[model samples]
Target: MLRLFSFGSGARLTMRTSEDAPLVICGHGMVAQRLIERLVALGHPFNGIVVFNAEPFSAYNRIQLSAVLANEIPEADLALKPQSWFARHKVSVFNHEPVTRIDTDRGTVTTAHGRVQAYSKLVLATGSRPSSLGISGEDLDGVLTFRTLADTRALINAASTHKRAVVIGGGFLGLEAAEGLRARGMAVTLLHRSDHLLNRQLDTTAGDMLKGLLAQRGLNILTGQSPAALLGKSRVAAVQLNDDTVMSTDLVVIATGITPNIDLARIAGLQCNKGICVDSRMRTSHPAVYALGECCQFGTHTFGLVEPGFQQAQVLAQHLCQTSEATEFSPGSIATRLKISGIPIFSCGRVQAGPATEDIQWQDRPEHRYGRLLVEQGQLVGAVLMGDTASGPWYADLIDSGRDISGYRDTIAFGQPYCEAAA
Candidate 1:
């Protein structure tokens, strides 16, 4: 242990290094790999490196999980950086081994293999765990959750033989699961707890409209129903709804939601509420410890999606590289965009407005187009669009900048012609 001085509160502290002081990072998820690239660009060749509980092969692009499953792309094509990238950069990776615990006071991390190592700086990018439905038969062999590449492969295998597939939950993941199963030529049935599909992102009318469109295409959409249990001894056979309705299926894919992986952070006694609470700089309660990706909660929001997680990675990378100008995530107004089966859906900011706020919408159900804009005090607060998400970028920019659309409110509701008229 060596004594170190810091300006913060003018306090002196002792730091421990394992002969060589290195910046240790945990988890090889998206955020962790990005941080490594930034550090390398900064010309900071790590003297000692500790990568805990990750595959030694370096990080890969998880976004292509479905594409790989569908055989549209290979696994190698999905990798964000190749194995040679990590080797050439001299960043040691601990493949297939995950860190089980961390001791902040001792500055040590214990891997599942019982190897305990010390670190000077630690970054947590453990990502998220699938939100499982705590129901009977959840552990059945045929039940699956699509979160990792391994899960995708298993799902594709099971789906090939399964004639009927019942998907639990109708959020983004649920819909994706349904689409993937459909692509596999399996009869797909979607069971959702909400009255409409994508209730979280769309209003009731919009959700029902989308549900109708999906139903027209031979997809079964069941809404406002809860799964009582999974019917099968060792495998999923049927999904029992709340009303004792048994929907027979050979496989069940639960895409309910996800919770951040904060078990290690919690055990370390780090201050956490909802997620490992971190500041805009992605710094946790502990001084030398930082957390990024889905495991972190910043500004009262937990990003379950990948884009914001990537943004957090960039922010932390710059900060760690000592070239950070803005230590906060500038996401430019958080947006919800789902692109499943070549269909575009974009929802951003506040879709619902109170009495003081105003909402303008245009409906073309015949053409399967729905668009709504929420304006408060003549400024764009949020917007939602389905089938016609081409204007998503423009609306997103308006929401991010708090641009006023009072002058063109009526024109904007009519779609592109409004932009043309305004121009």
Candidate 2:
């Protein structure tokens, strides 16, 4: 058995004797696994817990989807701490069970399998679904969204037959899909609505350079273009742009974006906007109920990335264990820098330059390298670097922590020696 807890300041927790404490966790995703581990470590035992997960496996690292799609790693390798992890922790896992509704009044949740269970405390960790472009022929056979293992397996099989493929969107997933498809011997045409790829994470100049590098690898990149419609009868045959120009294609991969899955929370009458709203403690609007990961929006920030989701889980676990206190999330403002196809791109804070912000840029034409730093009020507000972005983390850390770097401002830009006392 385990201990049952209630919501209150300095509330006493009752440890279970013969009867097990009823603590139900819905959605067995990344954040849920971490929370489960934390609960186990805290000596909290659950009584006949019901965990609903749509995926067949217990849990897995979703960030490796691109590596799986690229055939760099096997599907089984993506799995998180195996099924034994749940067994050892004494948690009843309901894999492939999608929860339909949660009854807040009765403190219970109903699954698609027609099972209803009571809970002392409930957790919502239902992840997100792939965004679809509202276009004709989207339901066609060859059109796909690479979000799950099934989707990646299908894409790998389709890649064998398709000589040419078009990817819609220019974000991390879209670029990964394009690179993976290219690795599979398919000519990939990346169609992006924005003028720059990874626009949300990189500046226009760095994005353009990344596009050029991708193009040099025989990947066709079409920027500032939106798909008017998918030109196909049954399976995908081609994709038509807004200019009415049709590109030959056999497969159309749409990586537009992802929308958080908050239907269950909404059905249960929980406060939700964009995602399930939670405070620093990961506590929802309802008492004794909590949420984490991409499904929950904290402090007007919804982190779609894995690292931040894991960080949120760690913070929430600490709160649940009564260890370290919870802190407010400052997502989207945090440092984001990652490599795409060996090209380094980094961005943090406000890269959008204006009169209030001083923009200092340096470009090495021969090396196809560019770096821009945005300074405001004696602080490094933003930065963007490409080709040679090894110092991305160094610069991003400066912006995130608001470290004083005015002394080395000029030297940092052009790889120059500091101007004597300015150092």
**What lDDT does each candidate get?**
0.80, 0.80
List the candidate 2 regions with Cα displacement exceeding 4 Å.
1-20, 41-50, 324-332, 365-368, 413-423
TM-score of each predicted structure versus truth: 0.90, 0.88
lDDT of 1: 0.80
Residue pairs with backbone overlap in model 2: none
RMSD of each: 5.3, 5.7
| Candidate 1 structure quality by residue, lDDT tens digits, 97-169 | 8898888977778788766667777888888888888889899889999888778878889877779999899
Best candidate (score: TM-score) = 1
Off by over 4 Å in 1: 1-20, 54-57, 330-332, 414-423
Tens digit of per-residue lDDT, candidate 2, span 76-162: 898878777667766789888887888776566768876666677788898888987888879988999988888898899999887
Q: Where is model 1 poorest over a 10-residue stretch in terms of lDDT?
A: 5-14
